[model samples]
Target: MNNLPEDCIAKILSLTTPRDVCRLSAVSRIFSSAADSDDVWNHFLPSEFPAGFAAPEGLPTRKRLFFSLVDNPLLLLHDPPHLVSF
Candidate 1:
């Protein structure tokens, strides 16, 4: 696994559950780095996410963005102040 390219490792990680990924990250330095890659985390993000929506300020990576949305979903407002849930 250490000999695998980072992108390849990330792709393999992408197929696993987020919980699996989190656990894998603790296995080794290489696994931890691959788990943190945007390539892996982006696969966890919803496909229907807003095209132009900006992530909250200071969120660093795709992994952080995924966790943020999971913990605190972003809310949008439509006309008439209707709440739009992501």
Candidate 2:
């Protein structure tokens, strides 16, 4: 019997890069469905950026954008499922 359950699997997946998960999804329907869930995307957000991010006006058409901030050297990464303005 497997020591890790579905929830554990999900948690492990949550920590992985989205690109890695997307590639894994293409291997089978089950992975595809789970990887596509909102939960996975939500889990990815905070870890990917600093707290209290506000998207700028006139956003680009690209699916992802790398932003440079004056205070932070690390580029800000944005994806779909647009973050609600605070």
Clash pairs, candidate 1, are none
Which candidate has the top score in TM-score? 1
Error of 2 at 20 (Å): 0.6
- Model 1 spans with C-alpha error above 4 angstroms: 50-53, 75-86
Q: What's the CA error at residue 17 for candidate 1, in Å?
A: 0.8
TM-score of every prediction relative to native: 0.78, 0.44
lDDT of residue 30 for candidate 1: 89
CA RMSD of each candidate after superposition: 3.7, 9.1
Cα lDDT tens digits for candidate 2, 1-86: 13445455555667888677668667555566566654555565546654444436542311122222222234444665344322
Clashing pairs in 2: none
TM-score between model 2 and native: 0.44
Alpha carbon lDDT of residue 44, candidate 1? 85
State how far residue 4 of model 2 sits from its true place (Å). Answer: 8.6
lDDT for 45 in candidate 1 is 82
